[model samples]
Target: MSEDLPIRKIIHVDMDAFYASVEQMDNPDLKGKPIAVGGGGKRGVVNAASYEARKFGVKSAMAGNLAAKLCPGLIFVRPNFERYTEISKKIRAIFYEYTDLVEPLSLDEAYLDVTNNKKGNPSASLIAKDIRERIFNEIGLTASAGISINKFIAKVASDYNKPNGQKTVNPEEVTNFLEQLDIRKFYGVGKVTAEKMYQKGIFTGLDLKQKSLEYLDENFGKSGRYYYHIVRGVQNSEVKPNRIRKSLAAERTFSENLSSEIFMLEKLERIADEVSKRLAKSKVAGKTVTLKIKYSDFSLQTRSKTLPYYMSDKSIILETAKDLLYQETLNNSVRLLGISMSNLNTEANKKIEEKSVSVQLKFEF
Candidate 1:
């Protein structure tokens, strides 16, 4: 097992219902009730939901009004970003006490490369348990950890036992673990991609492993190479600390396919508004406006426009996206639509402003 694997010690830690749990912790009156944290207004979507809410089928990204209908007694609490940020800092501090290679995926989850940790702990499993214990003892929040040789499997292992538990995928167990795992459950595979794999009769990691790299590449594009390697329990991407988001986006998969020009134009306006708000919170802007389209036939296409200056305001983002959408020729009735900004500029670079211009390029996913 040691001969076949590099034997790296990676750990992925994820907090359970972070925002919702924090709300419950800070307010005793909220305990034992189904609660969701986010904007709960008519147009808002849930950001996090307490475990109690899960019974009622409430989920993050679910429309708030829909969630209310599902869980009639559900409590809505506006997010306290300052508090969540404070807690996240404490959690990161605890991880840094073990290893400096901490890659934060979001405020509630991170990947830690503890191959050579400060504690001189040889057992990654023990280290993970120690970290979770520290987080719970110090912050009063439960965290789940996954331990393994690489980031991909470690992430998968972390989910095996969630909300205050941990799972370790040892070197000896990597092969069988991958074989039995469902394709849909793999870390990076999304619903659309999973459906594509299913259509090709690839239902599990074992099934995915049967395809040649050439076949995968032809069928799935660049991500095919990614699938080929991770299924065999081989992934070498380092746990990079201080990673910056390359793009900020907002997209929606409609309940029904949209082919009407009027319907799509309205959807794009709404999506652009959402994207602009996210960019504002991040205090960033970008020069590239990317429009992503997924058809009902499951085909995907991306069109992008790069402006001379960064624009994060809704009006500019909406206009640029509209331009890109109009230029493209839809191959089928659209099932999904997205707008994203890239070539990001942080708040520090906010001083430079230039008139927006559209330059279109096509990309395949």
Candidate 2:
């Protein structure tokens, strides 16, 4: 680890099987049973699975029918986003009690910088413990947390002890911790990237650290620099309290695959309406309009057009999406259609540069 790198108390908190847990919490009959949160109808996907369901190899995003096949008698419950959002708001309220420097990644996870928390607590580990305990008590939900010197390590550690647990990588342990970490477990390394690293004979952080910057860049392009620093426990990105929206999107999977452009036009209109509503609600518009198509074979294709002016009108968005839709020939029957707007007006809302800690702080939990 470099001596000049920032050392701040960062914590990543993630709720356990949030949607499934919420369903179980609300319905006593669903407790202690294998359940998945999402529609069980054809074309339905699992949004979240209970631990009992997971034991049978059922997981989120799996086809609902496949999940049922994996776990015989697996119960599927429709998603209740409104209820989930209600619970999420309560959980976020608890975070604000400890620190204003809270960054929510989603309704189920967040990152908090508690180095200068309201409680004046110096032990980030204890702070995480307190937050988890409060969530369990107040919201009837279990949360796992990771505490460390920076966001990347903290995020990784949070997964170490999941479903009601916490892991802390103290300042002194950061180097050894990261060096022993599996390359696949590094924050930004996905399945494809992990395979790429494996081909390069890089299976662990120690292996990644051995590669020169130019060597990594030559092979991995822009993410090469990210791989270089994170392996050395040198991530300096801060948790932004006001994380601005970069894009607004909406999509839907049909009950039956559409075989022609005319059938998709109505569906695209509805999707555009949703995207336009989201853009209006966010008070932002964009120059880029993208249309995403998912064939019945599960292949995805996206066509985008950047206009001279920003658009948030449903009619205009529908017109652009229709153009993009006809721009390419159908590869197969379409299972899903989506519309997204990017190059947002929110870009101007970005705050000025925020500095990370430069001096080492003597601390222990």
Candidate 3:
């Protein structure tokens, strides 16, 4: 596998605290405060929490009520999707300015393969630095970047210097770097998996590398193969640019089935807010809004509205979704309600410019 691998240059760019950062960027008054974005009501859930809130044990996906309890004076705000979508588009545009081999993980993170970049910059470190500066100057948001010969090392490098910073992992230093890294820090190793590794006395990349591939496979199942390769600084994942997006949706499974018109409408408002936020972050407007309902009896139904104009507005999206929901008769109590936006705009493309390669770093292997 190593014999066929290309000497590639990969950069992983991740925006620090994406949703929370957007909120702070939009409103200066909220800066440096413990802020959470999501539900403010009795059944509210946190969609995003700022770094300040993180210090107080607040986190995304946690119940908003619980989050408020964890941090005194925690401020909660509903999400704004349209604005986030606009900012995401601007950031993506900046990425295309460097190389077209860009693979977006989400609105705020992506991987770029610049091994044969259009700009012909020999030093991947310099390219990452340039990208970081441009994002701060143009988008008014800070981003962290990592540059390396492969994605695994690059991702770790990016996190080393975060919140408006950049770093590089040269090929020669890869071994020493991985040797000292905690086992939990290895990609694809999550909390449960890390705990299992710790039980087996696998606490660092060096320890993982010492295990035979067959032995790892017997214990970790399919993931053990991935661990074996990454510990050896081998990653084959490609920077797949222009990957098609699927499954654009928003949904809410109510705590209880509801028949009240006013209550249903309020829930639709919150769902629309979430759907819009994601749409804006992707910089794509949707032509279809699908409303889904699951009855208490485990029966399901869906209604959709196709708009003449693509939209990312919260009001327009919610109104359309509500209209679709209202079109159906509420003969049975609805237990789950969902709204999804699809048929996104795909006009964006990456562009790489031309330049001379200045220097090449030789690998000792």
Candidate 4:
């Protein structure tokens, strides 16, 4: 870590089981029950699971049937995007009260740069506390926050104390905090990557730091450099208020594998409709349409076509997907189908706003 590098107060705010929490808040009967906000049918995937359900190993993206088997008493509620979006707006509005450098990661979480803020508060931890308190009082839901010198550490810290709690890693504590951290807890390391790290005997941040840059690069490629820097607290990514979305997509897994094109058209129609609706909601169009197929054997394939002009209409999207579907003969039965749009109109090269940093500045814990 270099003392000359910039020090900015970054806070990551994540809503607690956002979709399930909203359902619980709206319906008093669901307050303490194990609830999942999504379809509970055989083919359905759990979008979000309440904390109560999580104790039984129910989690988002788990198959509804598996979740049901894990928590037999779980209740399922359909998703209401309009309601979630409405509440998300209110939460973001609260964030803007303190900082314009707010970067939303999703409807349920965001990164806020409050090194200098409208409230003129010098303590980022205090600001995070205030923000969480306001969300609870105003939105009728709980939120968790992480405060630190950068977005990565802040994101990791936020998970330390969850479901209506906050964690702060001070500037002086950053190195020790990260060194003692579990390899799996590092933000970007998923299950597969963690397993790979385990095979390489890198099970902790200290273990990761012990590997040479050459050794890591030889073993992990480009991500090797990323691990080297982030483990040593050298991430320089900023919070961009206008982060552009690169792509939009919608996908569904089926209860039964479809072997013929006739059976797929109906599914394609529904998938295209979803993609179109999402594109319209974002108010963006794309030039490329992609068809994703997941075979019954779990082999994945994608076919894409870049159009001369951008489009966001359901009819056009469905037609393009249909064309891609018919472009090739079925290699195997497909258990999942997806439609995606890329080269979006939202993509653009915009200058990132720069801020000045003072050398050896003091940051409150």
> Going through the candidates in order, what is the number of backbone clashes in each?
0, 0, 5, 0
lDDT of 1 by residue, 1-365 (tens): 23443346889999999999999999989998999997666656899999999889999989899999999999999999999999999999999999999999999999999888899888889999999999999999999999887788889888888779999887767888998999988877999999999999999999999999999999999999778878887776778795767899989877788986578999999999999999989888899999999898879899999999988989999998888888957788998899999989753344433221111111110
Looking at candidate 2, the ten consecutive residues that score lowest on lDDT are: 352-361
Residue 365 lDDT (model 2): 53
* Residue runs of model 3 more than 4 Å from their true location after superposition: 1-4, 244-249, 255-365
Best by TM-score: 2
Candidate 4, residue 225: how far the Cα is off, in Å: 0.9
Between candidates 3 and 4, name the one with more favorable lDDT. 4
**Candidate 4 wrongly placed segments (more than 4 Å):** 1-4, 313-316, 349-361
TM-score of 1: 0.75
For model 1, the superposed segments whose C-alpha errors exceed 4 Å read: 1-6, 249-285, 290-304, 308-340, 345-365
List the candidates' TM-scores in order: 0.75, 0.95, 0.71, 0.92
lDDT (10s digit) by residue, model 3, range 35-112: 998886666889888889999999998978899999999999888877777888899888898889999888779999
How would you encode candidate 4's per-residue C-alpha lDDT over 229-273 as one tens digit per residue? 888877768898999888999998988889999999999999999
TM-score of 2: 0.95
Model 2 Cα lDDT, one tens digit per residue, 3-91: 76555789999999999999999998999999999978889999999999999999999999899889999999989999999999999
Give per-model CA RMSD. Answer: 9.8, 2.1, 7.9, 2.7
Worst ten in a row by lDDT for model 3: 351-360
TM-score of 4: 0.92
